[model samples]
Target chain A: TAGITQAPTSQILAAGRSMTLRCTQDMRHNAMYWYRQDLGLGLRLIHYSNTAGTTGKGEVPDGYSVSRANTDDFPLTLASAVPSQTSVYFCASSVLLAGEQFFGPGTRLTVL
Target chain B: SQQGEEDPQALSIQEGENATMNCSYKTSINNLQWYRQNSGRGLVHLILIRSNEREKHSGRLRVTLDTSKKSSSLLITASRAADTASYFCATDQYSGGGADGLTFGKGTHLIIQP
Candidate 1:
């Protein structure tokens, strides 16, 4: 069912350029999240959405924004990229807020 | 900033042996989940243990949660080469912080040698 899918498996962008990482889940999960994994630091939450229309900031949400316009898609946008934003980005979703999550393959972003 | 921290950043063992990984969190959690990530792949959920629960099992995976210790362990018995991957522990917290996303540890890279 393609539990979850992320676009642009990897991207190399120049600092100050903008990009959007797309996430879509077919499981019809009620909650979706965006996280970035850095070496030695693990995965840090950047943003989350409890439902299609409601969103909230997470542990590391600066320089990024998200929009959940519908039930299937939760897209994260980098208005202006920075070198510190380079990391492996993951998109996850769960049917229940506190249940196990399904993750996408991930997008490797390198901002230079 | 991560709530959970996994021990033994890397582990190597022979196939058919047992491998165990530990995770400790700084805050109370509603549930703790174990996930495995193969090289260049997305994470796959292995099991989940709720706070009130002491242990859980699925296939060859056994997970034990000690809420009092704020720690959890994942044990994989009779490990196989296919079991070589990075194991991560994630926690969904207890506080009512809206949209409190799951916090993950740095992960334990387990290698099963043949």
Candidate 2:
């Protein structure tokens, strides 16, 4: 089974342009998350969804938004991309809130 | 803010040697987990230890957690080049029995020389 899959393995965008990173899990998980990994900042949570139709802001959620319309999919959107948003974004899913999360391959975004 | 910090930002050792990494967290946690990431790839869950458990072992990897000190250590015995990767410790902070996301450390970069 494809535990989780992310679209556009990599992308390059101009500043001020909008983009949406797609994440889908076949594990039928109840919890999904979006995280951005920087060089030395580690992985910071952008947003999370406990279940379908419920989304919550995380530690670093200022410039990002997420929607969990269903259990298998959670997408992160950047209304207007900025150079600071250039980082590796990861999508993960877990069976429960505190369970071991399975991550997708990851999507590398570059904002110029 | 990050909940945990890993000691020795980077480590290098020859194959057949044992490597150890340490992690310290700030707040109380329900569980702690270790994840490994190869270059340009996503992280893979290695192991998880609950607050109540002190030590756990799986294959060549051994993990020890000390709730009293809010610290943990991971040991890789007979390491190989294939084990070379960045290891991160994540903490599932206790939120009074509510949903909470795991906070991760910067991670330790391990290099195994052949």
Candidate 3:
């Protein structure tokens, strides 16, 4: 089992461009999350899904959007990327909310 | 702002020694988790302790939680160079279904010298 897989291992996009970070998990977990890891800031949640078809905003959700159409995938979209949005993005899945999670390798994005 | 704050932003220790990292958070939580991230990699779940539990052990890892003080500590016995990485503490402020996912601390950078 792949556990969790993320696409676009790394990317360099221009400001105001649009991009989507893909996240898929074979664990069939009920909860999935999107987080951005930045220098000195740790990892901040951007969005989360309690289960398939339900999504919620997180601490730093202003510049990002997420959709959970199914249990295996939760993708985060940045409509207009900013320099500040350039950071390592991680996708995680847990059997239940607030439980131990399994995380993907991560997507490194650089916006210039 | 981050809810959890890990003490000693950075720590360097020699092999065979024990490395201890502390994390303190604000507010009540159902459980607290500790994760280790190697360079350019995703965070790996090391251990988790519930609010009611005082201490937990896993292999060479030991974790202690003090709900009254809202603090937790992670201890790695007989540290090796492979233990060199950034350690982060995460907590779910509310159990079950809280919109705000897990809150992570800035992390304690642990460097184990050979």
TM-score of chain A of each: 0.98, 0.98, 0.99
lDDT by residue (A1-112, candidate 3, tens digit) is: 8999998999999999999999999999999999999998999998899899999888899989999999999999999999999999999999988789899999999999
Clashes of each: 0, 0, 0
CA error at residue A57 for candidate 1, angstroms: 0.9
DockQ metric, candidate 2: 0.87
State the local distance difference test value for candidate 2: 0.94
Best candidate, DockQ-wise? 2
i-RMSD of all predictions: 1.3, 0.8, 1.2
Give DockQ for candidates 1 onward, in order: 0.77, 0.87, 0.78
Model 3 Cα displacement at B36 (Å)?
Answer: 0.5
Shift in Å, residue B53, candidate 2: 0.5
Complex DockQ, candidate 3:
0.78
Q: What TM-score is obtained for chain B in each of the predicted models? A: 0.96, 0.96, 0.94
Please provide the root mean square deviation of candidate 3 (C-alpha atoms, Å). Answer: 1.3
What lDDT is reached at residue A52 by model 2?
Answer: 97
lDDT, each prediction: 0.92, 0.94, 0.93
- How far in Å is the alpha carbon of B65 misplaced in model 1? 1.0
